[model samples]
Target chain A: MALKLPFLQVDVFTNTPFKGNPVAVINCMNIDESLLSDKQLQAIANWTNLSETTFLFKPTTDGCDYKLRIFTPMCELPFAGHPTIGSCKAFLQFTGQKTAKSLKQECKSGIVNLTISSEGKISFKAPRADIEEIPQDVINEYRKILQIDCVAAPKLLDVGPIWVVYLTSDAESCYNANPDFAQMAIINNKYGHGGIILAGKKPGSSQDYEMRAFVPADGVQEDPVCGSGSIALIRYLQDLHNFTETTEVNITQGGRLTRQGEIFCQIKGNADGAFSYISGGNATIVIEGSINI
Target chain B: MALKLPFLQVDVFTNTPFKGNPVAVINCMNIDESLLSDKQLQAIANWTNLSETTFLFKPTTDGCDYKLRIFTPMCELPFAGHPTIGSCKAFLQFTGQKTAKSLKQECKSGIVNLTISSEGKISFKAPRADIEEIPQDVINEYRKILQIDCVAAPKLLDVGPIWVVYLTSDAESCYNANPDFAQMAIINNKYGHGGIILAGKKPGSSQDYEMRAFVPADGVQEDPVCGSGSIALIRYLQDLHNFTETTEVNITQGGRLTRQGEIFCQIKGNADGAFSYISGGNATIVIEGSINI
Candidate 1:
C-alpha cells in the first residue's frame, strides 16, 4: 500500500494564487523521522523544484508548538520567511489550531514566535539580528550590477538568515532596473550573503516602502517576495534613518518580478537597544492533496 | 467539491525515480477545452515549477492517438523530448492503453510516431533535418566558451528544433567541461539556436558516444537526456565520419550535472537521401495522484 502524505501548496506574501512565492508544506508528524532520511527530504524538495519546501513535525523542544524543517531545491535552510508563513497556515488549518492566539516554531535558527488574530492575520517576531559593514569595492560592484548610481552604504545584516541591504532613494529605480545577474551572482558568492535587498520609500501608497531582493548566487535571480528580507530592511532603516520604536510600515516587494507582494511590518523598541520587528502577510493554499512520495 | 484531475509525475530518460528529469502529466480529456484557458494552463505549469508540465487530450487530428501540450515554468515549448516520453508513459498507464504496440502524438511540432515494445521500451523516429555550415567566428567563440582546442567543422542542424552541433574528438573533455554560462548565454542568443550540442565517442562503455547540451539562453544550463540532440548527432556522424546506415550507438549525457542519462540511437538510410534515426529510453513513474488545480 502507498503511504499518503498530506501536502499543501501555499502561496505566501499574497492572498491571490500565482501571485506570490509558493512553498510545498508536508505534515510529517505521524511518520517516524528515521524513515525519512536527509536524502529523501532533499529529493522531495528537488521534486518540487521550488525556492523552498517545508516539512512539519511535532516539536521535540520546549516552548514550541511545532518544528519546521525547510529545504530548497539544492539544500536545506535554517529558516525562511515565506515557508514559515505557509507552513504555519497549513499547520493551523490542518490541526485546527487557528483558534490559538499565537504559535511558537522551532527551526534550525531557533525558536521564533508568531501572533495570530481572529481574522487569520499572522505576524512573526523577527529573529535576533546583527549588523556589519560591507567592503567598498563589493558595494561598487553591486552598484554596477543593479544599474544604480549610488546607494546609502550597503550593510550586511543577519536576521536568522544573512542579507546585504542596499538602501536607495528611488524604489522605482530598483523596481525597473534589470541587473546583470551573472555579475550579481559573482558578487553574492564573494560576500557570502543570501542576496542584496534594495529598498526605498513608496511614492504615494499607504505602504511605507518598496523593496526587491536579488539572489543570483542561489540561482534565483530575483526573489518574488521575501519576508526575512523585509524584516532585516526595517532593522537597517531603524538604525540608519532612526525610525521610531512604535513605527509601522507596509512593504511592497516583487513588483519587478510581477509578484507584487505586500508585507505589513511593525517595529517595537529603539535601534540603540533591543528591538523586535514583526512581519505579516496573507497566504493562499493553492494546492491540497496527499502526496504518495 | 473540488474536481480531481488525474496526474502523474514521471522521471524521463532513466528508469530511476530521482535521477532523470521529472515532468508532471495531467489528463485533461474529460475537462472542457474552453474551461481551461491558456492562462489557467500556464498557471498550473507555474505552480508545478518543473522544467516542463504536460497536458494530455484527445487528438483532433486523424491518425493521432492523442494530443500533448507542453509548458515550462516560464513558457510553452513547441517540442521537447523528455516531456513526450513522460506524457506517453502517463497516458498509456492511466488510460489502460499499454497493450498497444505503438502510439501517435499530435503536438505543436507536428505528428510524432512512437513505437512501444512488449517490454515497455519506447522509441521515436528522428524528425527530418537539414545541415548547414556554421560561421568560423562563431566556431572560435564556441571553442573559447567550451575551453576546447578544436572541433570538426561545426554544423547547424535543423531537426524540428535548430541546434548548433560541435563535434569534438575528446568525449571526456565535453563531459567534464564547464563553460562560462554568462558568456555562453550571450553566444546562444547571438546564434539564435536552441543550444549547442557537444558529441564525441566514449572510450570503454558499450554506449559508444557521449554528449552534453548547454542551453544557457533557455535558463537550462544542461539537458539531462536530449533525445533530439542524440538524433542530430548520429546524423552528423553518419555524413562526416562515413558511418554505416545500420550504425546504432548508445549515448550518455548530463554527467557534470550528475543526471547521467542514457539514450539509445539508431540511424537508417544515407545522409544523401531520406534517413530515420530511432531514439529510445526508459521512463519511471514516480508519483501518481489526483491533483486539484
Candidate 2:
C-alpha cells in the first residue's frame, strides 16, 4: 500500500526550524526492508537528506513492540537516539497504535529503552560506560585545536568507548568553542579510539557534571546530544567527585550550530562498579514522509 | 554573480551510470571561501547535495599545485578524495588551464602530489596512515548483524579522522551486505567506534588489501572513494606483508551505488613509519554550469 508518511523536519538540538540539527521522522506503514534493498533505502535516505531519517516499523504485533530504522544520507545506522524518539512519537500519531507508553528499541547497540511522557517529552536510557585512558599529547592537541578553554582536563573515561574526556566550564564556554579542525585531525589521527569531551557544571545544579563533545575527525564536528559522550562524562564525574547516587546532570551541546539540547545522565551504583545511563529529555518528532525510490 | 553551473551526475566507482557510486560534480569558476560566510558555504554545499563536492579554490599557483575545498550535502568536510580528483579534473577544463604534466593538491589533509601520466591516468601520494586494531566482539557482531560472511578477522584502522577501516573478503559478498543495523547499533552503542571494512584479494594481487567501508553509525553508511580508508589500507598491507619497498595495490569501491572507481595506492617507507599515497585512473570532465547558491 502506498503510505502517506507524516514527515517532519525539525532541528534535533533546537526546537525551531533550521536552527538545530535537522532530523526527519516518518510514520511508515506496510514498508519493510524485506520489501526493500539497501540501494532503495539509501536512495530514500539521500532524498530525505537530513542528518538522519527514521521510520516506525509496525510489525503487526499489538502487545509486542515495534521496530525503527535510522538512515543517514550514506548508510543505515543500527541505533540513534533522536531518530528513535522522533519516530516513536510519529508512530504514535501514524497508526494511532497504543503507544507502548515507552519503547524498547532493539538496535545494534542493544535494548535502548525510551519513555515518552504525556507532555510530549521523550527520555531514553543508554547502556553503561566502561572508561579507558588515552595519551596525554593527543589530549593536549585537541584542547589546543578545539580552542574551548579546558574547564576540565582530558582523561580516559569509558562511556560506550573510552572517551578522551575533555571537561569545559559551562554551556557558554562550550558554545564559544572554536577548533582548528586541520590541526585537530593531527591529534585524531594520532589516537585511534578516543574523542575529546568538553563539559562544565550543570546549569541548575552543582550536583555532578555537564559537558559537550567534538569528534569532527570522526565525521561529527559537534553532536546535538551525544549519548556515547555522555556515558563517558557520567563515569568521569563519578571518579573525580567521589560521589555516586544517580549523579544526574544536563550536558548541553550543538550550541555553535545553534541546535542546542541537554542530555540527562545518572551515574549510579557503587565504587567497584557504576553505570552511566544518559538521556536527553525526550525528542519531538520533526517531520515525516516516504520516498519513491 | 550567480552562475549556471554545469553539473554531471556521474557514477563514480563504476563506468556505467547507476551501477556504481554517483557523484554530481559541478563545473564553475574557482573562488575564495574567505569571501563567503560558513553558512553561505554550507548553503552552497546543501545545494550541491553530492556525497562530496569540490570547489577549486583557485587556478594552480605553483604549476601543478591546486587548492580546493570539499563539502558534503550538509557541510564542509576537512578533506575528501573523490571531490579532490573530480574537482581538479573539472577545474583543468573549466579554466581551460593546461595540465603541466603533473598535479598537486593542497587539501585539508595536506598536500596530494599528483602524477598525471600521458595515459590520462592520474596518481597521487596520499597522507600517512594511522592503523588501529579492531576489537574481537565488534567484528563478530558485524558479521552476524550485517548478515555478511567475514572472510577473516576484521581490523579497525584510521588514515585520517574521517576514515575508520574494516576488512572483508570479496565485493560480491559484502557489496550487497546489509546488516540489521538495529543490532549493529547495539554493539556500536556498546563499543563506540567501529565500521565495516569488506574486501577481497584485489582483482589480482597477492599481498595487497582491498575493501568497502560502511559507517552507518556515523551518518554515512558507505562512502564513495573514501580517500582516508584507502590510505590506511595501503599502510596496513605494507606492515602486514613485510614489504620493504613501495607496496602497490588497487582498491575498488562504490560499485553498489554506481559511484565505482579504483584508487591506486603505493606504500613507501619502513616499519617505523610510512606514507600511503593513492591515485586513480579516471575521466576528467564532460560538465558545464555553476551553482547559484
Candidate 3:
C-alpha cells in the first residue's frame, strides 16, 4: 500500500508567505474509513506545525457538497472555522473541486455554505445552531481563571453543532487583558463546546468594534479569523442591535500569535432572529505548491 | 560522521501520567560546525510537536553557570517560565548537576534561583522583575483579539531577567478563551513572551482571587500553573493590596484546560515595601518513557 501523490502547503490565516499560520492542505480523499488514522494525521499536522491542517475527503454518505476532516498538531476536532474556510479555498485553488460560486461543506455538524466571491473572499453561511445559558458559578470559574470582574451573563451562541458564549462587557477589555495561556489550554480540553464565543463593542468608531472567539476545547487557542465564531459573534451582536440586514464589521484576529489580519464580514439575520447569511470580503490565495514528501 | 546519541523527550507541567502539557527536553550539542545547523535544531523541536523544548550544553566560553537554549516547535525563545522551571527540575532530578539546595539558573536575562526541596517541590525564584505601565490604546488593540473590557493600568513585573505585568479590568467579560493554537506557536517563535497574564479579585471568595494567562506568542494558548506568572501575580497582588511579611495565597489556573491546579504561593515583601522572597508547592513526575522515533 504505497501512497505517494501530491500535497500543498498553504498559509491559512494570512496571505503572506511563512508569516501567517501555515496549513498543509491535501487533496480530497474518498470517504473510506481507512484514509488516514487520526494519529497519523495529527503527526503530519504536527510535523507541519501549522495552526491547522485539513484532509479534504469525499463524503461517505453524500447529501450535499464535499467532506473535510481537520486536524491539528495534537488531535482531531469536530468542527473548525479556518480549517473549513481554508480547506474550501485550497480545494478550489488546488484541486478545482469548486464547481459553483457557493459550496456546501459537509462535516459532522452537517452542511455549511461556503461562498467564494469574485474578490476571492470566502463566505460561510453556518446552519442554525443552539446557544447555552451557563450558570453564574460556572461563569465565575471562568472569571477566576481569566482574572477579571463579572461583566454580564454569557449567553450560549451556537451556529452549527454547538457553542457557548462567554461575554465581556466590551471588546476593549478582551484586547487589553493578559491571560494564563497554560491554564486556558487545560480548561479548554475539559469543557467541550466547540469553544467560547466572546462578544464586545468598541467605543469610538463604527469600525472600531472588537470580537474575539476562544475555542481551546477544539485544540485551537485562538483563531485569526474564525468563520464559525464570526457566525456566533455576529448573531449575538445582531440580537443585541435587533437587526435583519447585514452589519458590515471588521474582524481582527491573531493578536497573540502570527500577524493581525482583518476580515470584512456582513451579518444577515432572518425574521426569526436566527442567523441567516454571513457574507464577507474575498480571500486571497497565498500558497499553492506540491510537496514531494 | 553519524551521531552516536540522539536527543530525548521529556514531559513538563503535569504530575500525573498523560495530563498537563508535555515538553521535549533535548541535550545541547557540540558537533562539528558542519554537522549542526540552527535550522536542524528548530526542525528537531518542531518534530517533537511539544509546545516548548529545551537544548542544554556547556557554553563555549566561561563565566556562566551553564548555557541553556529553548525552542518552540517553530523557533527559538529567549526565556519562558515552564521550561525554565521544568528544565531545571529535570536537570536536578536526572543529571543531579546542581547538588546544592539552590542553584542559580543562568539565561539570557541573567541568573534566577532554582531551588529543590526535600518535599520534592521545585521552586524557581525568579529575579526581582518590573511591571510596565500599559496605555489605553494598547488595551484597545488587545480588545480586538481578546474581546475583553475593563483593564487595569500596565506595570512591569520581572523575575530574574524576564519582566512583564498585565493590566486588565473585569474577569467575567472574558474567560477560558481558546485561540488558534498553531497561530500562537508561530507567533511565539517570532516575538518573545508567549502568554499574557490577567487577574482580578475572586468573586464570592474571601482571600482567594482569580486569573488566567494567554500566550499565543509561545505556541501555547494558555498555561496551567506558570511559575513566573505566579511570582508576578503574587507580587502584583501584594502591591495592589499592600500586603506585608509572608502572604500565603491560592491561585487557580487552567479552568479552561480542565487540568485545574492551584498554585499555593507565598509572597515575601520587604519591611519598607521592597520585594523579598517567593516560595511555592511541589509537582509530581508522571511520565518517564522514550519516543520510538
Q: What is the C-alpha lDDT of each candidate?
A: 0.80, 0.57, 0.57
Ranking by lDDT: 1, 2, 3
Cα displacement (angstroms), candidate 3, residue A195, comes to 4.0
Q: Could you give the TM-score of chain B for each candidate, in order?
A: 0.93, 0.79, 0.72
Least well predicted 10-residue stretch by lDDT in candidate 3 chain B: B284-293
lDDT of 1 by residue, A116-200 (tens): 7677767888777678888888788888887776557888999877898887766677677778888888878876887888887
The stretch of ten residues in a row with the least summed lDDT in candidate 1 chain B is B238-247
Candidate 3 at residue B109, lDDT? 58
Native-to-model Cα distance after best TM-score fit, residue A116 in candidate 3, in Å: 1.0
lDDT of 2 by residue, B77-123 (tens): 66655566566566556656665567777777777776666655555
Q: After superposition, how far is residue B276 of candidate 2 from its true place, in Å?
A: 44
Which regions in candidate 2 have their CA more than 4 angstroms from the true location? A1-10, A26-29, A46-49, A58-64, A74-76, A97-100, A147-153, A157-162, A202-204, A207-211, A268-276, B1-293
DockQ, 0 to 1 scale, candidate 3: 0.03
Q: List each candidate's DockQ score.
A: 0.39, 0.03, 0.03
Q: Residue B100 lDDT in model 3? A: 52
What TM-score would each prediction reach against the true structure?
0.89, 0.49, 0.49
User: What is the C-alpha lDDT profile of model 2 across A1-293, one tens digit per residue?
Assistant: 33233454444433433333455555455656466566655655654445576665665434436666778766787766556656665666566755456766655556677776665666667654565555667666666777766655567765444467776776566656676654565576676654567777656677544456666555555655666676667667766777746566666665555445655656656566645465655444322333222
